[model samples]
Target: MSLAGNRATMQSGIGMIEVLVAIVIMVFAMFALISMQIVALRYQKTAHLRSMASQFSADLADRMRGNIRGAHDGAYNLSRQRYPALGDPAPSCPGPGSCTSQELAAKDIHEWRTGLGNAMVGGWGEIAGSVADGFTVKVYFLDMLAAADGATPVARNCQPTAADPVLHREVSCYAAVVSP
Candidate 1:
C-alpha cells in the first residue's frame, strides 16, 4: 500500500548500541596489551639482573683461581659487612714492581665490588663458603622487578635465607650463589 518514494526514504544505518559495544571491546583490548607490556618489561629486568649477578660472581671466582695462594691465605675472603671501597688500588704482579698474591687479590676485590655497585641496584657480594671447602660468592640485589611486600631481606652473612616467600615491601631481594 506504500508508495515507492516513501519506501526509499527509510535509510539503513548503524545503531548507537553497536558503536558503544565496539568502543568497549577496543578499550579492553588496549588494556590487555598494556598489561602484557608491563609484565614483559618486569621479567626482562629480572633476567638482566640475574645475568649481571652470575657474570660478576664468575669473574671473581676466576680471579680467585688465578691467585691460589691468596685464595688459600684468606686474602680473597670478603665478609658480608666489610667491602672494598671505591678508592682501593689494584696492583699487578710479575711486572716492573713485583706484587704479592695478596696485593693482586685486593685489587680484584676492589674492582669486583665496584663493578657490582655500578651494575646493579643496591648490589653487593659476600663469601658464603670458606676457602678450605671451596667458596661460594653470594651476590645480593634489590630485585626491583618484583613488587614486594614490607620486610625484605637485608645484606648479611649467609643472608637472604632460603626462604621463598618475600615478607618485605618496596623491593624483593634476590641472591645468586656462585661457587668457585
Candidate 2:
C-alpha cells in the first residue's frame, strides 16, 4: 500500500480509539452521577424521617405542657378516662377542684390521644392504629433521667402493653408538678 494510504488508515484507527475512549469516559461519568443521585435520595429520606419523628415529639410535648400549665399549682392528673385519650381536658374548668391532680392528668392524656387520633391522617395515622407498628405516649411523674432509672419515685408510668409495638419509641414528658 502507498505510505499515504497506510498513514490514513492508521489515523482512522486512532480516531476510532479516541471515540471509544470518550464513550468510556462518558459512561463512567454517568455512573458516578447515578451513584451520587442515589446517595442524595437516601439522605433526603433519612432527613425526612428524622424531621417527622422530631415533629411528633414536639407536638406531644407542647400539648402536654399546655395541659400541665393550665392545671392549678402544677398539680395535674394523668389518666385514660377522658375522651380523645391523648391528654387534654375539655375547655371547661374543673369545678371546685372536683378531679384530683392524678385523675386530671390521666383524663388529659386520654383526651390528647383522642385528639391526636382525630388529627393524624394518612400513613402515620394508619401505623398508629395498627397493633404491629403503632406507638404510644407515656406520662412519667419523675424527671426524664429518673424515669429511665426505674428507681425514682414516680406518681405513675403509663405504658402500652407488649402486644402494642406501635408505641415502642421511648417517649417521655416531664413537668414541674409545682407551678413556678
Which model scores highest in lDDT? 1
Per-model C-alpha lDDT, please?
A: 0.65, 0.40
Instruction: Tell me the spans in candidate 2 whose CA falls farther than 4 Å from its real position.
Output: 1-14, 69-180
lDDT tens readout by residue for model 2, 116-162: 44533211210122112222433221123333445322233332322
* Stretches of candidate 1 exceeding 4 Å from the true structure: 2-11, 80-97, 147-158, 161-180
TM-score: model 1 vs. ground truth: 0.73
What's the TM-score of every candidate structure?
Answer: 0.73, 0.41
Candidate 1 lDDT score at position 86: 44
User: What lDDT does candidate 2 reach at residue 106?
Assistant: 48
Span of ten consecutive residues with least summed lDDT in model 1: 162-171
Which number leads on TM-score? 1
